[model samples]
Target chain A: MSGLTLIASYPKSGNTWLRAFLASHLRDGRPIDLNADLSEVPNLTSRSLQDCHAGLEHSDLSRQEVALLRPLTSRRIAREQPGFYKTHDSNLVPPGAREPAIPPDAIDRVVCIVRDPRDVAVSAAAHFGWSLDDSVDRMADTAFCIGHSPRRLNANVEQWISSWSAHVESWLDAGGVQLLMLRYEDLLADPLESFTQLCRFLDLDDTRHAVSRSLEESRFSALAGQEARGGFRERSRTSTAPFFRAGKAGEWRTALPAVLAERVVGTHSRVMARVGYG
Target chain B: MTDGLLCGWRIRSDIALPELLDWQGDDRIPDLVVRLGEVDERLPEGREISPLLQIDGTGAGLLQVPMVGRFLVRPSGGITIAPQPEASEAEIRLFLLGSVLGMVCHQRALLPLHASSVAIDGGAVAFCGPSGMGKSTLALRFAQHGHSVVSDDICVIETCEPPRVRPCFPRLKLWRDTMEDAALSPEGLERNRRGQEKFHFRAPHAGVREPLPLRAIFLLRRAGSGEGEGIQRLAAPLDIMAALEAETFRLQVGHALGRAETLFQARALIANDVPVYRLTRRADAQPDRWLDAIAATIRG
Candidate 1:
């Protein structure tokens, strides 16, 4: 609760869902406004936050410089602006950087949400307008990163997400921070139990009614309906479907081709099985 | 050593600053002097303003960019830079004129907005925003139409009645796609940093020597799909003040120098006297669609 309490996850891995529950829970079960209220657990990598702390524009720096600079700013954010923040950064060291962007000393705790790689591929594809094959390949790519600006400035600082398997393993192996791992499928199965665990981990009000009320407020249907009415600012610019498209698990059986699903499972088999994911 | 004009100040520097205009003002002891010297890793009595910035009790500031260099800025208008052996001039000049310039403005009690402004209707129409919000890109669009660019990254405000903007050089830093969209080639232009696609495209026209009256301020933001996109004037004083505060360059340095009241008054002046607006552009839509609308809005 002192340093940065990060809700860290890979993209399309129910990161927003956890943040939404926390947002409502923090307000004592207030009905959450999807767009406006999410700032309670704001994105840690947002460009403005990085720029203000870094004292220089990330757009002007090369990738290596940004990688080096992030850890410094991370410590600043920890010391000055300590609170809940969401990120999709892998815990591994980025390319050309000595340490992870968010070093251990800068973190109070980590609530890492990981989803089944197969479902993540389907969700990521729809969210990014990538084909399922491309999504699978990108998630398997060791050098995969997000928010990198090649030809223009990106909205957020670059995050070295690496491969999904590497991403999963990195946080699992992260030291010196209290970590709580949650499976996206488990959250979907029993929202009350999963979210209660989340609240307890973060030392919030963990009573059943409070947890259930927050879970009910931030349920998948409500979030989808809200996005349908007013667009999600966090939605990818290239997103083909709605930001909350098909929150169900096991949809890869239908949406994803067999080969693509196989590729995800093959590359991420060890981490997947270790996390009790299919 | 090179002599140049930046933010209406005669600058004599050992570093080459090609973006600045050749000094035309009568030499009366250069207002700012830049030289090569040793810079310490950290200030002993200085308080940390940010990860890379520090400000001492004397209101002097130190800025160190890891691979570039360190800029030691004093209240007496002296700057000392110790560059890395491998640092390029482009990278060195970037911080010298950018972050160092903002620090100087704070030291001089001037307001520097993190904006890119161009002359519209013979006055400065400033576009303020955080990085990647298209402030420079919009200025580039205006510059392409032959509008005189007042400033690229930091817009210095002369705390006068109308809050005139001191004209910096018309060196706009643009990304590769932006230049391509504007039909300008990036082949010969120098990159903002090595291995970056962003190029420094200098406007062919010489910069206006005199400060232009501050006509309007537009805070640029990107709207997501299904969200409203247009220019809406901020009428509330708090909203305008908040927007201006958000866009103030190196605002923390100002506060650290015990200039919070001065900055607050500066923000109050903009909020009270000038018309500030929120201009929203769709993230996926054609960005140039707003050029004409912005011109019309500014003209009105």
Candidate 2:
């Protein structure tokens, strides 16, 4: 039976982009509408978990403020087909830690998006309103691999890489989850090839040529045009801005200063080389 | 202390009412006073009283009911005079005494969830859902169907003794709309003028005292019109957690640590002891079908 495919990634790691691409590619060559957003999708988060059992035990959370995703995480594998979803809680401990992570059987495939640590830092800074220095500092501290500083903490890139490494290690240790590693740069380099590989993993039958055409059809310019003119509102939730950011790799090299870049390289030099970024 | 009309109790404690501007009571003061008549009927001279807060009173003429516990005495002839005994502390202490906390503190008991519980012939059926998901409405219907009223709103479970949930109530409450929609008997209906969403129906003495072993837990949902089966049950912990969390109340209770542990234990009891199902019904559907299905499951 086809199980749920989780478009898993650290926040802002292009999970949305992948989802949009797949959704648009799957439909009969029709562009996926962004009108409904992630929530309108079926079997989204269960709102009940927040109220009945979770509330009294967790009264600090208001009924309206609780999220629908926390409760639905366990129901992922139970569906006839795997459900695709996303999350941002980095502290989601290993299954044995405090609360159990997502159940094992529910997940058929786990696709984690790994970007160059420096680029992740830059994207995080712009998207989350975090300064480059603090992002790097906090990131490094969280991964427990390298150092971070506020003023010119150069370890941004290294820490970014280390965070991904830890995430990968944790998922691998968990076992039973089919892991597919994707580099953001590779997708940017050849959208068609990347789309073809992802479709194959998801067990879809669309040809590479068709996927390439679809990718070209759904390019940053095309996607942004739909976003700017509200044409994509049928599929996307956020009306304020396009989900597609700068599709270029190494934008962080120029956006993030030399000091931060040096720190990234210092912390993630080995992983960078492993991913051929050295 | 006897006030001739209603008994007056005073609790002398160090705890002070911070909201009151000038509390000159060096001795004891009345915190909870359950008066029998309307506020207009009785009043002692030089006494201060405020209409009940938070509660839209259905049984009494007062606008609000005292929370937890407070002093109860009749107001005398617009008197607003005389020093009344203060027992806010004693009331809270008594509340916590008869309360689930009282049972737990005394016997390490668990608190039953704050939802509606209905007692059928052999066992009780609990309607567990968020506040506005029609829990009380369904429970009230079950009671009207000659099922014993285990609880109108909140049911307390005492796991230590006989493993039973005691239904506590001064009265059974129903919403105005529910009463109209269900076509329930209006014999004992007391219209609550304070709020549109509340009313009081005195629970029959027979239903109040009878205890039913809880047999089934149902999570209610509106029917979805589609190609798929509108409703199907699945044994998913996530669904249970999701349903329960929608109604979870004390995430962090009173700065205490083990409060969460107690809550988890209560959650586990419902999860382990009873069968839970997601019951979907159309707008015009009667709730008895779902109740009967649960009852059949319990019988099996």
Alpha-carbon runs more than 4 Å astray in model 2:
A37-81, A89-96, A143-162, A172-174, A230-243, B1-300
How many Å off is the CA of A39 in candidate 2?
Answer: 5.4
DockQ of 1: 0.65
Q: Which candidate is the best by TM-score?
A: 1
Residues B133-230, model 1: lDDT tens digits: 88888888788788988999999998778789999888999899989988989999888899889999998766888889999999998875567899
Chain A TM-score across all models, in listed order: 0.98, 0.72
lDDT per residue for candidate 2 within A113-224, as digits (tens), equals: 7678788777666654668896666445544321122111111111122365455445445567787778788888877777788878877756966686557655677666
lDDT per model vs. reference: 0.89, 0.48
**Docking quality tier of model 1:** medium
Give the per-residue Cα lDDT of candidate 1 at A259: 81
For DockQ, the strongest prediction is 1
Q: What TM-score would each prediction reach against the true structure?
A: 0.94, 0.43
Off by over 4 Å in 1: B223-227, B284-299
Winning model by lDDT: 1
Docking quality tier of candidate 2? incorrect
